[model samples]
Target chain A: MDTQGTFRQTVEPALVRRLQRGELAAFETIYRRFERAAWTLALRLTGRADVAQEVLQDAMLKAFERARQFRGDAPFAAWLRKLVVNEALMQLRHDRLHVIELFDETHADDDAPAPWAHADSATLDRALNRLPDAARAVLWLYHVEGYTHLEIAEQFGRSTSFSKSQLARATKRLRELLAPQAEDTPCTIGSTTTA
Target chain B: MHDRLDHHRMTGDASLAAALRALPASTPARDAWPELASRIRRRRVVRKAVWFTLPAAFAAGMALTLAWPHLQRSTASPAPVRVAMQSSSHATPPAAPDIDALQASSQQWQAWVQTLDRDGAPLDGRQLTQAVALQDRIGLVDLQLSAARNPSTTVGLWQQRITLLQQLGLLHLQPYLVATQRPASHDHLISM
Candidate 1:
C-alpha cells in the first residue's frame, strides 16, 4: 500500500480549511481518519485503554479548537501525533504515574543479547507492557517514535541522561523477562547466535 | 570476544525494535465522535454564555454603584418641601412655572419607563430585579432633589438622577443588546 499517498489523502488542505472555520463535519472526518492511530499511541503511552480514549478525545478537541493555528508546515497527521503524545504525557502527569528513576544502577550488568530476540510481536508487546511507565515511554519514544534522547528529555522534563538510563534499564528488564523463554526455544531460527 | 558480544547485542536490539515497530495500531472499541461533538458543543455554549453574562453583570454593577450614593442622600435629608413638591408634581400642575417643569420631568420619567417596557429587550430575572431596584432608587433621589434647600445641591442631585435614569435604561436594554448584537460565530452556540 502507498502509505505516503494514503496519509496525504487523509488531511487535504480543503478539509483543514473547513475545520479551521469550525465545521463540525470536517472535524469528524479528521477524527475518523486518525482515531485508530491516535488511540493506539495513547494506549501505549498511558497503558490503559480507558485513559487512552480520554486522551484521544481531549487531544482531538484541542486540535480542533486550535485548528486555525495550524500553518501546514508539517503533515497534519504528524502534528496530531505530537498532540496525542502531549496529551498522553499530561494524563500521566495528572495521574502521577510517570516515575523517573534517578540512577541507571538497576541495569549495570554486562550487556547480554535479549533472550526473546526472536519472539513474536505478541510476546514483545507483553514484555513492553511489563515495563515501568517511564521506561516504556522512553523506549517507545526513542525506538518506535524516533524521538532523540534530548527530545524525550524535554518531553519528560528530565536530562538526556535520564532518558538514556531509563531506556537501558527497560531494555535490560525486557531481556531478563524474555531470557527464560529463550532457554526453552533453541536460538536456531534467525537468532543472534552468541559465541 | 567483546566485539562478538557487541555484534550479538546489536542484532538482538534490531530484532526487538522491528517487533515493536510491527505492532499494529488498534481501533477503539467504540465511536468517540458523538461524545467529542457533544463536549465541543457544550464548551461553545459555555463560552457564549460567559461572553453575554459578563457584560450584563458589569453594567448592572456599575448602575448600582452610581445610584447608591444618591439613594442614601435622598433618605438622609427629610425635606418637607421636597415631599410636598413631589406630591404636587404628581397630583396637580403647580402654579409656579418651575414647579410645573419638575412635574413635566416626572411625567417624562414615567413615559421613559413605559417606552422601555414596550420596546426594550426582555430582561432575565436578575436584570429585571436590578431594573426595579434602580427605579426605586431613582424615585428616592427625585424626592430628595425636590426638597433641596440649596439650588446648587438640587442641580447636582438632578444631574446624578438623570445619569442614574440613563444607566437604568441601559440595564433594562442589556439583554436585548446581548441577543441582537452578538457576533455571527456565536450563532453556532445557540443552534447547538
Candidate 2:
C-alpha cells in the first residue's frame, strides 16, 4: 500500500524543524518511529543482534548530529536509512567480518522450483541470516533495499558482476537449504511456487 | 524453450524478491531510547565543554603572547643592550633607531592581542593552541631583536617582528572575521 511513501509523508516539516532546533523530544520521536526499520536493516546487514543494536545506536546518533544537514528534499526516512546502511557497512569493515565466497560459475537448473517459494517469512529470515556476511548484505541491498547492481557494487567496492554473482550464489544457497525440507513436507503440491 | 524457461525463472525470482521486500522490520529486543538519550546528552555536554574551553584557551594564549616580551625584558639583565651599545660606540647605537619603533609596534600588537582576548570567546581548542604558539614565537623574536649587535641584524629582526605581528593580528581576529563572514546559522549547531 505504498508503505514507503506513506512513511515519508508521516514526518511533518514542523517536526523536522523542531529536530533541527536541537529539541531532544523531536529526536526521540524520530527514534521511536524508525528504530525498528533501522534495526531490521542493521540486523540483515550484520546478521547479529548485538552488532545490529550497536549499528542502530551509532547511526541514530549520527542522524541526530547531522539533522540540520537534512535539506528536506529527500524523505527523512530515506536519509536515515542511508546513515544506517553506511554505519552497518562501516561496522562490518571495522570488525573485519566480510566473508565473500567465490561465485560458482555452474548455474542451477532453472526448471527446479525454489524451495523458499512458499516458506513463511520467519523461516526465510532465518535462512537469510545463515548466509555469509557479504552474500547476505548484497542480497538484502539488492532485493530488500531496492539498490541496483551498480549501486550494490559501488557500496561494496566491487564490480557489478561481483554483485550479480553474489546475489546468484546467495539465492542458490538459500534454495538448496530449503529444498530438502520442501521435498519432505506434504505441502509441496505444485511446481508453480518458484522462489 | 530456453527463453520460456528463463522467463519462468525470472517470475519466480520476482516473487521471491517481493516476499523479501514485504518482510516486516523486526523490533529490537530492547528499547534503545534510554541509552541513546544518554549518549546524546553526553555528546552535548562534550560539545559545550569544547566551546567554552577553546575560547578561554585562546584568551590565555593571547594573554601569554602579549605579556611574554615584557616578562622576558624584565627578567634579563640590561647586559645585552649594554654590550650592543659598547660594541657599536664608534657608530650610532643599533638600539636607538629601532627600540622605540619596536616598543611601539609591540604595544600596538599587544593592544590588538588584548582586543582579541576580550573578543575571542568562540575560538576552538586547535585555534587557541595555534594562537598561543604564535604569541610565544613573537615574544622570542622580540627578545632576539632586542639583543641584535648590528644595524643590519636589528633591521632583519624588526622585519621579523612586523611579520610576526601581522600573523598574530590575523590569528587573533579570526573568530571575529569568521563571525562576520558567516552570520550564525542554525546549521552551525548541526556540525557540533
Best by lDDT: 2
lDDT of 2 by residue, A39-128 (tens): 888988998889999999988987988899899887888888888887787777567455566656788777778767777666677778
TM-score of model 2, chain A? 0.87
Query: Candidate 1: DockQ?
Result: 0.21
lDDT of 2 by residue, B1-192 (tens): 989998988887887788787666677888999999998886675466446545754564575467546644543447678666657786644445344555555566566556556654456788788878887887898798778775545655655665676676667656544533422332222221
Weakest 10 consecutive residues, lDDT, candidate 1 chain B? B183-192
CA RMSD, predictions in order: 11.0, 10.2
Docking class of 2: incorrect
> Which residue pairs come into collision in candidate 1?
none
Would you list the clashing residue pairs of candidate 2?
Answer: A117-A195
Instruction: List residue ranges in candidate 1 displaced over 4 A.
Output: A2-10, A98-111, A185-195, B1-13, B66-192
Error of 1 at B108 (Å): 22
* lDDT of candidate 2 at residue B20, scale 0 to 100: 85
lDDT of 1 by residue, B29-134 (tens): 7889999999898667546644654465455456545654654454434567766675667653322333334344444544555666665457889988888888
Cα lDDT for residue A83, model 2? 81
